[model samples]
Target: MMYQLGKRIESIVLPVEMLQQLKPSDFPNQWEYEAWQRRNLKILEAGLLLHPLLPLDKTDTAAQQLRQIIRGALEKPLETGKNNKTMQALRSIALSLACRTFDGSVSETSHWADGFPLNLRIYQMLLEACFDVNDETSVIEEVDEVLELVKKTWVVLGMNQMLHDLCFLWILFNRYVVTGQVESDLLFAANNLLMEVEKDAKAMTDPDYSKIISSTLGTILGWAEKRLLAYHNYFHSDNTETMECVVSMAVLSAKIMVEDISHEYHRTRKEIDLARERVDNYIRSSLRVAFVQASFQYFSIMSLHRMSSTR
Candidate 1:
């Protein structure tokens, strides 16, 4: 009886579109709803069942571990203000999260090919199909190719929450960034991709994706100001002081470009230049200290890796 009940639970948790087809009225009894919930609970508990060798708990831990790896990767250039530290950190976090969710393991060596690549390809295909870009015959052929790829990949990887989020990010990036390209078809395709992602986002109940998307959008918007002033303000209060200093310097450079030398271009140019230069000098001094801290972090990781190998 328990086995039969469990089987019934497993059968009902289909795609939302499929679930919508069957009404509670069709179930006729409370037992059916209870069985549905039980199956969902079981599926949720299993967590990336394709990689059974890696237990869900391990996968969860791996996600947390990858965050540390990303921090290490970004810390160096960030400290020296050689790159956009906060933006680099955000990308690292996104990539780390995707790796954990898709690969079902955390290691120094992991890439989108592990699982995310295939998932993203299918997502892009689906977005294209919705627009009927090709002729009727070509559309059918393309969809078949996409479906076959999805089938083979899923057989190897199984579905996971991380793949879903990666797809969302790909769609978002394609829509907002890639769409700015000069190509008309590409821009249209990007619009279609974002619409699909927005639909998927609405379906998800998790708060993490929401938080990351909101923060990422804010970061991108701040990047558009031509000066890094907005970026500095956003990351200043966070532990990313190195990134803040870099952005402050960038903002100072931008101020210099707009003011001081361009007296005929603007009235406040000289005043802004003097103030910005002072701030820039202060940040540069602080950055030297940050570089030392970043160097220590890098060496410590290398030392730990060496010790582990010896054991």
Candidate 2:
């Protein structure tokens, strides 16, 4: 009887689309609903049991352990018919949450492979809901906490680091878009992502990864353009530090374009090139070339001064 009950818990699957509409009040006030909540809570608890800081010496085993824990939660009786669609959704969410929470590897199992994109979309929707419903202060704190977990996970996964980082940055980017406040860490993550991608160029070839990367690059460039316009307005208001940071980011954006898209070696070079050109044209139309040149020169001089002062 206990075994059968556990299986029923695992079989509970919520559609990815429904996650956005989910609310604390949405929990049905009944014994079964309460049981379902408790089960999910336990799964989340077990998911976070292992330390994320541990060396990747046994990551494969860690992945297996996570999979087993999820499987254990999912154990069901033979009499309970399969809900294939719901199971797929649950498995996708489970694997994504497990990977995000535990720093475990993303399972390449058929279920995970088929539904990774949908899983990502669901996570983003949940995040958006979190921001929209909660007070900004609490939401920022919560989002930051969640993002820290993601950053830790990024340390463990080798093959999926780019995808994870892009997701992380996109969350921050979306946050900034919705709320005008910028997080410096988003820019920092962007820089690190560009460095990682440059070091391993093959990530550009994965269709899913490439699709997200292309869209994210445009979003980032758009943000930078907005910042540049702000700098242009305040150029005489003693915002040198802000101007310098914005210019440095723009330079990094250009470097990403030149290195990733412009390289003839990239498999999706043509599509990426067009994307880059679109962003460049957008930037050019919004800001002056001479202003950009001046900001770069100013940034360079500031760097030199800091170097001299340290010596």
* lDDT by residue for model 1 (185-272), tens: 4323333443444455445554544444344434432443322333333345643543443344344333333332233555554544
Model 2 regions more than 4 Å off: 1-26, 29-116, 125-159, 182-203, 226-230, 234-238, 262-311
- In candidate 2 the C-alpha lDDT for residue 279 amounts to 48
Compare the candidates by lDDT and give the number of the best one.
Answer: 2
Model 2, span 1-311: residue lDDT tens: 32543533122222222232233456666455445544553433333333221222455554555456445544641111145544354455444543432345543321221133544553454445335354441245466676555443222232255565566557655564455544444445445565555454444666656566666666676677666644545344665554455555555555565566554544465655644564466457547755777899999999999999999
TM-score list, all predictions:
0.25, 0.44
Report the error of model 2 at residue 162, Å.
Answer: 1.3
Candidate 1 structure lDDT: 0.41
lDDT of 2 at 166: 60
